[model samples]
Target: MLDQAFLLYGANGYTGELIARYAAAYGLQPILAGRNKQALEQLGAELKLPVRVFALDDKIAMQQALQEVPVVVNAAGPYDFTAKQLVEACIAEGRHYLDLNGDAIIYDMIHTYDKAAKDSGVMLLPGAGYDVVPTDCLALWLKQQMPDARSLKIAFAVLNSSLSRGTAINTVLKLGLPGLSRIDGKLVEEPVGKRGMYVQFPGMKKKLFTMSLPWGDLSTAYVSTGIPNIETYINMNKAAWFFLKGQGAYNWLLKTKLVRGIANAIVKRQSPGPDKATRDKTNTLIWAQVSNENGNTLTANMVVPEAYTLTALAALLITRKVLNKEFTPGYQTPATAYGTELIMEIPGVQRGLVQ
Candidate 1:
């Protein structure tokens, strides 16, 4: 048995493939798994790692796969559909569950399994990837800086990156959904792009325009820091911001099955994601602020590698920690489980307060 190995489901997907390819660099091996037998075999052969063919629906096979490894890193998307099932299996098998999910609803869903996971000695950590790693770490760091923080805001932008087919499809599915925020300790719905601002991120000469977004931190950050008010944002250009601000006018059309089908088809016909050249040159900018009751605020900025690159590295980092017997059982965000400095573990990450 390989001592440092985990089962990587969805290994056929773009992000999953990346994680499998990079596993050796982290001094680990991944047992490639997924429903696509042919694809899994191809990936297994290339990586020279074991392959387990099983779908999430196959209870026996999945359990066997779980038995082969101490951890499971789910790189699948539309996590709302995938997370709960994998989490249940992990709990039953006493295996740690980790995923690259950034959906608030999935976080809320997985949180309900805290006690079961704790009892089973399984760590239920979602957003082990770029979804909440950088932002969650920033939230905790800011909380430490302002212990009495009343509100928190986080914003991020992929300087030059493209989404994988799975991510693009998920985005299409959420076209008509409302934005979300935590207000006074309650999750509330708000219009997408309801608010816009300009932020001068560190290392950038000009301020980037950002608009309100319903990021996963709306759920994870509150649990991580206990801040009563929280909101998230994404960087956008002026034209895109204006277009999103007016999303109400055509949201109905966007939600229609026909439109979603067309959009998904287009995404499928496109490249899997940014090419290697693009990913190598890309970066992500993250900005965050925490404020006290008196309106005093402290702001911080961070820059990391492109989204997909960071996701693979971050996921493996957490997996390695679990392999090393370092983890808190039960539901956890990255920073809350690891600490605010966890984000710094990834290569090419720079973070500091904005003076």
Candidate 2:
């Protein structure tokens, strides 16, 4: 029964702005919000949408903000600090929740809210963006193909080299942390970037050096496909790999509160994100290969719009679904709640290109 308009918290962030404009084009007047008064005002002025400026930690402000919108889409990253507060507020206010977060730790922690969310009669769906939408849908499709699959591996070959400031923070939040894998149906942490391989993305001719990275799939894929022993990789050059590996050695530095503060400050000062030309020109190719103990393999890939564009599309798509009379409350995985064809609904999403 939550029928108010959307509250797009963190609406001035890179992906948040894209979602805001896309929603406007869809005839939605979402309330723009975030901690920065200047950025919020700037975005509100351009979009002509109402702005609500408030810090995440202000419970009264957050609660009042939630009451103004039936659903809230969080575009903030390093969601470690933001997601919990907003989600809790949504539950308290009887508002639905969605976000662009892909941190496995956050995803795992959020799963604990399932019963509370269901009791509140509102959905609390994360991984609603490029972080897990495309990949999660693909995992379920592979499961449909090979129901007996025992292991799964997903590789991300983001044809775009430009990492948005938002994504950089998401990456930095877990930097130096061990990679995660679901082994025999339980989440396990292993040294990330410990090994490497060459993976030829389906749409590409040449192979790229793919290194292990802890992605959201470490948790969501299991809920979607029940495939144990999963590993997600990202295409990276030697220099990127070197920096990633070096994190393990210098993790001591990353653990310091001062270093965390400095990193967050650096990210805040970064440009909002790539330009329109950059988003249009770049494609994100994600490949997933699933196999059973019998050696039968089901492999495929998806060629989608740039990560930010896809995030906007996915956000809109989910918002529409959440607005329907028939809603599935509680914590939900992308594919588990919507099925494998979810990404197909997005504009410019190409799928099933096998290697």
Best by lDDT: 1
Which stretch of 10 consecutive residues in model 1 shows the poorest summed lDDT?
Answer: 76-85
Candidate 1 lDDT over 1-355, as tens digits, reads 4579999999999999999999999999999998899999988887798999987889999998898889999997888678888999999999999999988888999999999999999899999999899999999999999999999999987777888988998898897888888899988888898889988877788898998988899999999999999989888887988888788888899899999899888989988888889999989999999999998999999999999999999999999999999999999999879999999989899999988
TM-score of 2: 0.93
Q: Each model's TM-score?
A: 0.98, 0.93
Global lDDT of model 2: 0.84
- Estimate, for each residue in 1-355, the C-alpha lDDT of model 2 and write its tens digit: 2353688988888888898989955556678899989988988898788999999878889888887778899987769888999888899999889998887788988899999999999888899999899999999999998899999999998875477887877766665456777789888878777668888786677888999888888889988888988888998896878777667678878767788778879987888688889899989988899999999888888888898888898988888777664468898888878889889998888887474
- Give the poorly placed runs of model 1, Cα more than 4 Å off: none
Candidate 2: lDDT of 172? 66
Report the number of the highest-TM-score candidate.
1
